[model samples]
Target: MSIWWSLHLRRDAASVPLARRLLLGTMETAGVDPDVSYDLSVALSEACANAVEHGGDTPDGPSEAYRVTAYLDGEKCRIEVTDSGPGFPATRDRPSIRPARTDAEHGRGLCLIQELADHVHIGNKPGRGGAVVSFDKILKWREDAPLMAV
Candidate 1:
């Protein structure tokens, strides 16, 4: 896995899919397993959507210029996405799944992120414009779980 990495891009609702793909590619390039890369894509997408829907309207504020950065150490991977809007502490109250129902596109992103990431943190960005979602992939797993030995 790569020891260092980063990505920055403008925030536009239309760019959400692109943002996800970019993050996925970055993780893959860093030698992450494909399933792990896909998980990061989904997590970043959910976090970005929150920034867009709830953060400020300024450029880079969710609907504005959104930036996502990801990196890996020997045992873990982490991602941080920044947007222009500001928010209070985030709750993992990401909504539940209803896979059989169509037209139910509004929620479910954070919920998925929360489930996949070994650890997740949400907070306001250090600067004036936005917030960040911090996620980590742990080095170890439950006894019966599959291993990501890469």
Candidate 2:
């Protein structure tokens, strides 16, 4: 069975946990292995937090909202977070993705997402204005998972 969900959420700090909780609940319901679920949820949280922080504000003001989407199909799960802020810098001008300075609290979210997910893509939405952070992992199911039996 395949499953998917999406949310259009306001760019607020509170929305971070909301997205993470929902992802956790869904993974639990689907009988995914706890360790796999935890890793994916943590990555989702980082992506959501980034959207809430950097996903808004045009010259006029904050854009007001962002989007999160998750998909579970066969042996894989994918999640994407999108924001309406100034998109990432062009590739030629973009800084390399790396760990933040040890003394820095900020700038670590992207790194965390990269470390958790099997495949990650971060870039601006084509023909529009926003950033998209997407990642996916190979899912592991619980021994008694109904989906596995199906």
Candidate 3:
């Protein structure tokens, strides 16, 4: 099935809930298990949040415009949040793994995204025009339980 709706909005706490409701409903209609819904929601939220914070649109503050595109194919659902800015920061200068310290009030979104999704990828446009963060989650494929001897 394809995405029912694709929305673009400003990056903010308010946007998070709206995105969650839409994704949850879409996943359920597509047959996603309830037990794993929260996981998917958390992961997607983190990805979007990261885009909100890192996506250069918010040069001074939260960028008023950011693109959020959701798509579903087969048993997997994917989302790509992009920003109109220079792609990922150079690896040497990028520190998305962890914040400066535990007490730091910022960071950790990428870490959450890594834990929530089956695959996460960050790439830059061919001309370094913008950045794209793709998130993919397996909604229906789970490892089979162990068999017991009869």
Best by lDDT: 2
Evaluated against the true structure, the overall lDDT of model 2 is 0.89
lDDT of each: 0.66, 0.89, 0.67
Candidate 2 residues lying further than 4 Å off, grouped into runs, are 93-95
Residues 1-150, model 3: lDDT tens digits: 454457887766678778888888776665666656678788778767766666664244434656777776666678887766555766664325543368877777777777778887776655635677777887663244121111
- Top candidate (TM-score): 2
What lDDT is reached at residue 41 by model 1? 76
RMSD of each: 6.1, 1.6, 6.3
For candidate 1, the C-alpha RMSD (Å) to the true structure equals 6.1
Total clashes in model 1, counting residue pairs 3 or more apart in sequence or in different chains: 10
Arranged by TM-score with the best first, the candidates are 2, 3, 1
Q: Any residue pairs clashing in model 1, and if so which?
A: 11-64, 11-65, 11-66, 56-85, 59-65, 60-64, 60-65, 60-84, 61-84, 84-129
**C-alpha TM-score for every candidate:** 0.68, 0.94, 0.74
